[model samples]
Target: MVARERERGFERFITFVDAIVAIAITLLVLPLVELTAELDDYGSVSGLLRENQAEIWAFLLSFAVIARLWFVQHDAVEHVVAHDKRVERLLLLWALTIVFLPFPTSLVAEAPEEPATKLLYIGSMVLSTMLLTHIDLLLVRHPELTDGNGDADPVDGAANVAMLVLALLITLLVPATHYFPLLLLLAADPVARAWHRLRGGGSRSAREGD
Candidate 1:
């Protein structure tokens, strides 16, 4: 019963954190209000927009990408409904990345080409991926938390962590290499689903991309 209460508390906290993350992305666009200076002419306004073109695109891309990552994490945890130390720590790490993302998004929007901003972006992604893989590990190793047959070769958890580490290391290339490994998130889902099917676990709604 105590564990159940803690799990409820954790879910409540996660809901709060998710709401804050949603608001932060919305705020990213709010800063662009400065783009409209004292210019009255339409052509002059267009020029101002052109001058800030890169910032706009960078913000939009980061916003969309972060939204995607957040959704994936949410789905990973949705049916989990637990709060043991392992799950708690993983959720906290996920929350940390969600909270940390806005600052880097703002920095990139202001200076997308700057190395610090780019590295920060990569680091945030790496942290997020690590936490997600941690979730997978918890579910895999602790049969109490899952169907007990969804994961095999727990090495999958290790591979997920290694993939994120490689991507993080490649951040030396800054913004250019930052998103290269993000595709792995989607790819892992199919691979994991296939493994579960082979193991006779069948496809869960979450893994089916619902």
Candidate 2:
């Protein structure tokens, strides 16, 4: 009975996390709705779209990022067989990170030109990614919390962290062209693979594409 209850509790926790993430993602679209509503009174749709292209880009970027994070969390937790107090705390922190994302997304849409805005957005993403990766690593270490089938590729995590650091550095060094370095994120997998090969380690399949 205790084992079953434990599993149920973990399932409930996962469900809660999923629900929070869903709400956060939904909230990201609200700004776009408001933007459109405001533009409705104005002239041409194309003109309005062109004028608000920054918001559109911000929304698209944030939406894609959130979706990816959700996928990673979902995938990472699939191997979970049980949980403890530590996992519960981490989950709460992770959920909080997800909840906080919409604020930065909005800031990006509203003030993409601001260095602080870009830094906040990128930093939020980095923090969330790091949290999720840490959770996965924790699960791998504590096999009792998960099925033995759980596998985490530390190389991928390292590569992702490196990419985020690069983005952060670019934002700090060249505020005007910070996003240019972020584009390098798309090449993270290749970089990780090359890094592993150079270190005489076998390359593993990437979790997902950029």
Best model per TM-score = 2
**Model 2: residues with Cα > 4 Å off, grouped in runs:** 1-6, 198-210
Choose the strongest candidate by lDDT: 2
lDDT per residue (tens digit) for residues 4-122 in model 1: 22256767877876887787677777657756653554368777687777668767777876786677666566556555677767777787787777788778766665767667876
Please provide, for model 2 over 139-209, each residue's C-alpha lDDT reduced to its tens digit, 9 standing for 90 to 100: 76787787666566656666777898888788777877846676767777788877766887664443333
lDDT of each candidate versus the true structure: 0.64, 0.75
- TM-score: model 2 vs. ground truth: 0.86
- CA shift of 204, model 1, Å: 6.5
Regions more than 4 Å wrong, model 1? 1-7, 37-43, 146-210
Q: Residue 91 in candidate 2 has what lDDT?
A: 72
